[model samples]
Target: MPAEADPASIDAGAALADRGHGHRNEGLAKLAVGAIGIVFGDIGTSPIYAFRETFAGHHQLTPDGLHIYGVLSLVFWSMMLVVSIKYVTIIMRADNKGEGGSLALLALINRVSGNKRWTAPIVLLGVFATALFYGDSMITPAISVLSAVEGITTVEKDFAPFVLPLAMGILAGLFAIQSRGTEKVGQLFGPIMLVYFVTIAVLGIVHIAADPGILIALNPWYAIQFFLSDGLTAFLALGSVVLAVTGAEALYADMGHFGRNPIRVSWLFFVLPALMLNYLGQGAMILSLTPADAAVAIQNPFFLLAPESLRLPLVILATLATVIASQAVISGAFSVTQQAIQLGFMPRLRITHTSASAAGQIYIPVMNWGLMVMVMVLVLSFQTSSNLAAAYGIAVTGAMLIDTCLLAVVLFNLWKWNRFAAMAMLGIFFAIDFAYFGANLTKVPDGGWFPLMIGLIAFTLLTTWAKGRQLMMARMREAAMPISIFVDSAANSATRVPGTAVFMTSSPDGVPHALLHNLKHNKVLHERVILLTVKIADEPFVEQETRCKLEDLGQGFHRLIIRYGFMQEPDVPEALKRLTGCGPAFKMMDTSFFLARQTLLPSSRPGMAIWREKLFAWMLRNAESAMEFFRLPTNRVVELGSQVEI
Candidate 1:
């Protein structure tokens, strides 16, 4: 067979293989660049404040060699272990159909668990983790921009008075442009961040060349000595040290945007090395100075690395980099909110797709403005990055701790790994997460209370919405008439119209309230009646072939179920067009979309507190219209309103 091989076949096979390899390489390169811009932004901007905060923060320490070496060692190992090993290597592998994040992981866990009794608590943990993410989303922009703008003070002492106003201005501008979309601006992010990382790496290398002793911080012994000698002081420094790895979760959260391999490659090769080098450079610079000079230099170590002539340019670059960082968090908040809405944990918000080619690039106006207001308030209140730093770590640490708990469940229950191995991994992650969380707790009296308060408020809103929705659905079902019963009773008697009526319902098996109201008020039914139910599955994406399922209930009635994953937005009309075996192709002008608008009347319900019910009512009242969220044609839509008490 080998001797008789056809020449044409051999050449074609070789060409195909070469093309495949080339395409793969190109795809990987593109993704790596994109991941560098989006996934690494928050952590990339950390060099602006992380090193300085450790030595000159709320719990300031003398910049002696031991203290400098110890803090650097802690920062280095924290990146290596917490970010590289725990998140990039381990947690990223536990993705749901190539999607990563707390909610995605929770959905995966729920799917695998088959609805066990313990699943409720696991789901709550994930929901709370998602809520805490909002707090992180708010704080990240405030602190990152403030820290970057604070660099101006180092350029010239007279610029100190402009710090807060400049930071607020930058943040306001960043949020202002969010609605117009970021597709254009986002293209430059990868290249800008690439330049930023390389510049920081070069700066670090130049400083490290002068004092090579800073390399000792790579050893574990320095961190050990730090804890052994300083006791409570060393432990407390962790509150600031945690800042170095703040955006590490973005690596996993944004994995769905970029694949695993690209993110891993970017982190190991570029991002990690640049960060460690910069931290070490800052440490080395501090060590070369006398105690008095080091104390002043530590106030803004990152900017001080540049020559006096270049400090102004460095500030400009830092400001741009911080804006990029803030953009990632804002975009992430939009993504997570969309997911929550689909998963039924939050109310629907207006979502605008900015890029037709990219599904992930979306804008939410309400979230954007709300975040901006909160961020500006934080900037004006804190007045400096150091004070804002105290509020940073709590939400991040809480989310990370929840991720560890969810990961343990994934390993032992889903992956079916060895129990001891899973427990061992869990123990290590729990120890680190608990320590960081505990350390940040000490800052509550200063400013840590801010994120904690945000987390609590967010958690309450999320859980209340979920519970209220469930109770409302149960009440609706109790009041619902069966579709079969309706079809049989009314098909022969009701007046038949010429067109199609698509009634949107949450429950597939019941007659929609809008349908009932239509029959009651109009005394007529369409010749072709479609009871449509949109469902969100526990996966990130649903295949097109399986998206719409049509069931013939007979007597001119058809049940259509449109399925979407949590990561997808539902388009009812688009799904309707794909439907087969219906009377004809769905024409927008010929079809009427029917929707039920519920007016919630808070009652003494066993499900939620009365105040929470009122809050749910308020949220329900403000939710985006179904016509808009489902992308239905405006003229073809009809809304039926009814009051429901739970």
Candidate 2:
């Protein structure tokens, strides 16, 4: 809900500054609706496989008596505690500009923790958790779609082989339309999800009617009995039950898009109850089924729970719902990567916006393509939806653990909440999330490689970005001119020009790459050569007055620092506008933003090991343009090429 100035003007000044438009109400409504598409999609569509897998997957819990009731009870309470209470009721309220996610939580922590050593690992964990979310995003579509399509085989055994290819075709078609804005496709998500909820509820209620006693199974005792009765196998079943709440984190992630109230209302009033009912109904079905038909029963639990006549249409609805869930996660991946790059955890890549109204919904072409390839490979490799379940739970549980760690910091330091409150919340969630995460560890051998692989690659990229940034800063500091020398030498000799030539730089010590290279190549300097370095402070956004630290380095080269929080990107011209009143009126007419483009000399420097050196070079090649980074005008911008090994 960025303020509607001219889009062109906004982009020219700063990428995403909180210019919330007059459409607060409109945006809120749209955000709520779109959130259903993105945030709750995975969790909303969970009934498709969660129960089915718990009773049938590798853990091999048979559908019988207390096992059936106990598992259903567990799923119900898990959704209530994990999704509805924990996230929707509590966490979603803690939004940063209507945005809720790990980053938002981390931002809150940084504001609170100040100078603690915990900050570094907290940030790394947040970034890694986000990386894991991407892996889940890619896998969700493959598994969900594959599961829904596989329902076809139960209705008609001959159609079994076509499920994977059909799922692939649908996925291919789904991604093919990314260039088209979400406005059109997104409209269907709300009403379709609404119908989806009603249908699953109705289907489940029909079964629940036959056995009203099934409702009694919702108690914690049944859940405890299931744990006591079944032991490790039942405890391990949490890996699959946890799947039901997989996309619950999205509720927070898409908070900015929908706002807190809508998501809260939607999940609490509608989505939660419907999911629980459907899950309970699945349990009831197992209670009625004979042991011999148990394998057949778990294979298609939702369909089997319903009258045989209603199976096909139910399958269709489930498929659509699952597809929508997948769509949300994929979009989430794009958003997180964008945030990572802006905050310096990742290399910047092309971010293409398809919609004018929704700045949040962007298409990262590389991310989209990368996900599609991995998802397709997952579908082809895993084949069955049950196999993909192992990969799914571990990533989600890992993210949940990270969230708890960050929340502990938030409660204790950030919010300054009491130790008891912090400990109580952390202990409860930690125990729940950690147990499931530990349980999911067993999934590693059976197709869990998917999330692990994606997380490792993503973690590597993020760490490399940090290391590269350090190397760049170190190199700049080494080559920098001492302020005493620069003032003594250039202060009296240089000619003063008309306007500011803001040299976006890495360090304040030496002459900036742009300043040195501009003088070397063009033999000209502006009236004010402002050396600007935007440092991402621990907090979310920098305060206005503290935004810039200006030093008179004389010779018209003002060594300047534009400080920003990881949540804020510095706007050079806007920053210059504020700095103007300090001395003279600095107009845009004569001002230019100069940037230094460092093309790595395929190197033999003492900077890094050979492999890392090559990795940095590869990353640099794929990175977004410096002009774009500095928010510089294309016409007046100058990029002077320099060589750096690290």
Report the lDDT tens digits of candidate 2 across residue range 190-286: 8888788888898889888888789988888999998888888887898888988888788777765566666776777777888888988887777
Cα lDDT of all candidates, in order?
A: 0.89, 0.75
lDDT of 1 by residue, 532-600 (tens): 989999888788998988999998899998999898889888888888897888898999999999999
* Regions of candidate 1 where Cα sits further than 4 Å from its true position: 1-26
What's the residue-level lDDT of 494 in candidate 2?
A: 58
Poorest lDDT segment (10 consecutive residues) of candidate 1:
13-22
Q: Which number leads on TM-score?
A: 1
Reference-based lDDT, residue 307, model 2: 71
Determine the backbone clash count of candidate 2: 10
- Record all residue pairs in model 2 with backbone atoms less than 3 Å apart, i.e. clashing: 3-19, 3-21, 31-257, 31-258, 32-258, 98-256, 100-252, 480-510, 481-510, 497-527
Colliding residue pairs in candidate 1: none
